[model samples]
Target: MSERENEDRKIPASDPVIRLTRYAQVPILAGLSVAMVLFLVTFFVDIYDAIQSFEFLDRKKTILLILNLLDMVFIANLVIMVATNTYNTFRLKALVQGDDYIQQGEKAYRRMKHRIVSTIIIISSIHVLSELLEFSQTTPLQVAALLGFHLVLLATYVVTNVFKSSD
Candidate 1:
């Protein structure tokens, strides 16, 4: 036994991945929580700015262009959802008490990372496709170069997740 457990202390059942997962959970959540609060604050401020622009009903350009508005909603929702998720993931008091909720939260946290990455990739692809459609003379070479880079990035992330995932 190691020095800390030399006296027959016990640890929860864990494999290398689960052990690393539990170990990795806290700092990641903590960092994400800090980010969440900052983004929520920013979102609120942006909303106020947007509202103020409504006061100028006669203006040519309103609060935000359509794409800008959509981007704000997407980012704000991401920040809020991730923030809540990180909190639930890192809050382990229920886990200590053997609560099912904590386990669910942990699972959700893991799943969310995969889901979020996939969502970003899909949305990015759509955005790029739209831009390509708008451009009258985008070259195959330029498009292929851009797409090749994204494909490499996507493959890398997928491989990393597969290697890291237990199931």
Candidate 2:
């Protein structure tokens, strides 16, 4: 064997700290997987519901369906980002080139923060749309609160993007 190869194999594969840290992420990955599966199940259920009620379809319902699907997509993206990034971050061997981009310290933190904020933006948008479509059942105070929440999310999204662009 080459000297370099032997040296590479010398890196400890049984370090207790590294093993603990890597396995610590197992629960997180499992949780995200469960959530992702639930989202997929909910997506299918939404499709089934729409099909079952095809004859009763209306404009508002159609819009809500689209928005709901979009929300699910964003949620799936967030779950995937967390699962993949966490694995790439802590695993002995990184998974992909994208993992290199998501390396440790400030860069990783910003990436995660941005992803979470973006997910929140999508969620808040979904809530706003739901409130708007069901306005008849929503009080003025409720509408105001929903709008306020959405605005805050929008502001965060904009600010984050602007600052991130500079970085």
Candidate 3:
């Protein structure tokens, strides 16, 4: 390749459109960070509530509270995963050149997808468990719906992993 061509390939952010799109991700990353913090705060507050309540001694109530906290953690982790991947995708390319950027971006994307699906499955399972703990208050239809949703998520995760392995 010509020297100019090589330089052009190395600096994709030189294009105004690419630069603008990358900069646009800044706000999204910021929003994700804020959401993660909120989730963390809520997680801690739930812990505090559990500690302060005599209901914590009750097996069902304690189990439910723990499941709720787990749900919050999974959500916070999802937010962190997205934000980190987004920043690395947009910012890292500008800092690194050549095939390394392409490979890293592709790998990061696949990893993010898997993590997101897995986290969703975990959150769904927690929800189902929590509902089951309060079975008296939960209608049979509600439980069935939650189970169906969890199964769908599980199926999706399996299909995605199958395709990924095939690739």
Model 2 lDDT tens row, 116-155:
8888887888879888888999999999999998998898
What is residue 82's positional error in candidate 1, in angstroms?
2.3
Candidate closest to the true structure, highest lDDT: 3
Report the C-alpha lDDT of model 1 over 1-167, residue by residue, as the tens digit.
57877433333444577656766866876786687678778766766776787733634234223334455556655665676676665565335434455567667877777767665666556445644654556677777776876687689668867778594
lDDT of 3 by residue, 17-109 (tens): 877889999998888878777877888888888888776999989889888888888888888888888888887877777788888888888
Model 1, position 146, has a per-residue lDDT of 66
Residue pair clashes in candidate 3: none
The TM-scores, one per candidate, come to: 0.45, 0.74, 0.87
What is the overall TM-score of model 2 with all chains considered together? 0.74
- For each candidate, the alpha-carbon lDDT, in order, equals 0.62, 0.78, 0.85
Q: Candidate 3 has what TM-score?
A: 0.87
What lDDT is reached at residue 84 by model 3? 84
Clashing pairs in 1: none
Residue pairs clashing in model 2 are: none
